[model samples]
Target: MLHLENLSFSVHNNGDSKQIISDINLDIKRGKLYGITGPNGGGKTTLAKVIMGILTHTAGHIYLDGEDISDKNITERANLGIAYAFQQPPRFKGLTVEDLVKIAQPKLSNLSVRKRMRDVGLCPEDYLDRDMGSGLSGGEMKRIEILQVLARNAKLAIFDEPEAGVDLWTIQRLVDIIVGKYQNNPEAAAVLITHNRNILPICDEIVVIEEGRIKHHGHRDEIWPIIRDDIVCQVQDTCRGEEII
Candidate 1:
């Protein structure tokens, strides 16, 4: 389980402190998938970074199971079975897909690598030797990033905008991969930071954040109806400016 108590993060912007995440609290359980959804710039990504130790929280405690990891760095958190898939997965100019996956899990076998590639709807023969640079599409990069995380089999995994820049078919495939992996591992947990309504139904819980604060958090059945209604309203009243991804 992961528990965050009054967690907050602030940064100095021109000598004035700006809070990106403020006094947030959450409890995420193992063997479940948790969905975090909100408008862009609502601090959903920042909160994920704090939990993954990519950003140090200015206040409060982060506990994984019963261990306090508030002061841990990104690498330390990763070593403790916490993994994060970034909104924009980094490009490795000189590495092939297989090379990068091997680096992510050095002990991973070729067969396992191929299987993961296939699971993400990529042909291993076509992609295993492909460079991890501009050659791949946004959807490809996202899947490869997800494959790396799944290969790690981390106890807690966080994926930021997993459905971004993908078509409907690709989104469904990505959802299947994420949900299947989490469902298969009873000791592991997943946090998905997504605006895609398709991903919400698979979650055990839904957390809604706005302006750096959680507006609602509860079981999926209880919270999703409200969220779904909001989405419908937003669509009906839309007139531009980045519709939810």
Candidate 2:
């Protein structure tokens, strides 16, 4: 369970201030798969980073399991069972898949490493011994990053565009892993930041962000139609374009 109250963030650009997020308040329930969707630069990723304490917020509070975590550092938040997977996953220069998995779960053996890779739709034989560096492709890095998240068994997982750069085949597998693996686990909850419609169906709730603010939050069925209508209306009116106002 996570709650963000009256959150706001801004940055200085060429001596001018630019607000990235404003008055964002949201509550994510346990064992639920929540989707954060919106047009580009809507602050969805920023909100994720704020919750993970990677980016310092200019205002408001963040609560994890009812306690305030706005002041916590990334390691502190991670120790509190909050995990974040970035849009562009970082490369580990010297680590191998086996090494990374071992780091996440020390008790896991080689067999478990293979199993975990299989679970994430990767070939254990191909990836288990591969270097987690430039040798691997972006998609491979992404999958490995996700595998690490799963291996950590964190209480709260924030995935920023988990489907990005992954092929359709892997995307389906990733979706299945998120829904079938984590969504059903009562011990953890997930927040998926993506614009992909393929993931919407499995989400328990869909939260739409626009211009750094939460514009809509509800069940998928309840919010999808509204989003669909809004898209149609915007396309019909060329002046509005695709901006989620």
Candidate 3:
């Protein structure tokens, strides 16, 4: 439902330009779980930010559902049903899960909230009234963050490494939500930037980003073995960023 055409982004400092994303042409479809992996600073996160309008692209266009959104701001993009889940969820010590969900989707009912909480392996009875203070573990916070994003009912979701700081149980829950819920829902699409081997194999497609460009992308069965070992960012000379055809 999202199309990126010849997308390129760069940064300028002291009159010197450094390219971060280069001509990244991609089509993200509904009901597909895409896994993005590459070396450090390979433009994976940058691309996600660009698509979410957090970072503007220097050239090319971004179209969502046939409408050009290249010039939309972050809030505008969010309104357009584009959601981004950061590597680290924000800490809101005084807010409860129910409060957060209400803020995310004011029209949502308590029944829907309960269902979403259960989908993420969280018990609404136990978590909805709890504070998001230091009492909540990293896994709990991450799951709640995911829940908030899901509450948006966004058509396209970009998750920047959901497995980054969570425990194995949380990671497992993420896998379950992606495999069970995300895969079954044809109304939305999700892009995940992850190096976790377990997460990679479950994706519908694997996209290898290197040197600010899409190096290789294909079905998981075809691309998994090639990147399984290299997902750790080996940074070999041959694998450095370059726009591969």
Candidate 4:
């Protein structure tokens, strides 16, 4: 399980301060898929980075499985079974897909690598031999990143917009891969940061963040109505004041 207690982070821009996250608190239970959605500039990505240790916190605490990991570095957190797939994946200049997977799972055989890629809706023969560099499309890079995470078998996986850049047909496949992975292990938990409503039904809980704080958190069914109503009202208001030519 993962817990954030009074977590806060800020940045100083030219002597002016801006808080990305403010006194946020939440608990994610084991084996559940948690979804985070909010408008842009709402600190959702910042929260994900804070949890993965990609960004240091200005204040508050992060605990993983009852142990405080607030001070741990990225490698330490990864070694502790935490994996994160960034919104924009980094490309290794010389590494091939097979090489990355091997690095993630040294003991994985060629058969296993193929299976993992297949699970993520990739063609193993074509992709495994390809270099994981600039040639691959964004969707491919995202899927490759996910393959590495799956290969690592991390207990807690944080995926930031896994569906981003992926085609609609592939998005369903990506969701299935995520669901299958977590369903395989009861103790494995996942945090899915996405804005697409298509994925909401697949999650156990949805945490709606706005302006650096958690605005709502509850079961998908319970939270969907409020979110839907708010979105509809906003759209209606925006369209009402527009004048026709």
Please write out the lDDT profile of model 1 over residues 1-245, one tens digit for every residue.
Answer: 89999999999988999998899989988778999999889999999889988888999999998899998899989999999988999999989999988988988888988988888788998999999977999889988898888788899999999888766777788788788878546799899999887788779999999999999899899999998998888877785575676
- Model 2 residue 61 CA deviation (Å) reads 0.3
Candidate 2, superposed: residue stretches over 4 Å from native: 235-245
What does candidate 4's lDDT look like per residue over 1-245, in tens digits?
A: 88899999999999999999999999988778998998888999999999989999999999999999999999999999999998999999899999999998899988988988888888987888888777999999999988888788899998999999988888898898888888436779888999887887678889999999999999989987788787788789989979989
Whole-model alpha-carbon lDDT for candidate 4: 0.89
Could you estimate the TM-score for every candidate? 0.93, 0.92, 0.86, 0.95
Q: Compared with the true structure, what per-residue lDDT tens digits does model 3 show for residues 1-245?
A: 99999999999999999999999999998999999998888999899989989899999999999999998999999999999887778888889989998888999999998998888888998999999766888778888888888788888988888888777766887778766656757899888899888888889999999999999899999999888656445656567876689
Please write out the lDDT profile of model 2 over residues 170-194, one tens digit for every residue: 8988888788767867888998998
* Position 159, candidate 4: lDDT: 90
Q: List the residue pairs that clash in candidate 1.
A: none
Per-residue error (Å), model 3, residue 58? 1.5
- Candidate 3 residue-pair clash tally: 1
Q: Which ten residues in a row have the lowest lDDT in candidate 1?
A: 236-245
Kindly report which residue pairs in candidate 3 clash with one another. 211-241
Q: Residue 40 lDDT in model 1?
A: 83
| Runs off by more than 4 Å, candidate 1 | 235-245
lDDT of 1 at 146: 83
Which candidate leads the pack in TM-score? Answer: 4
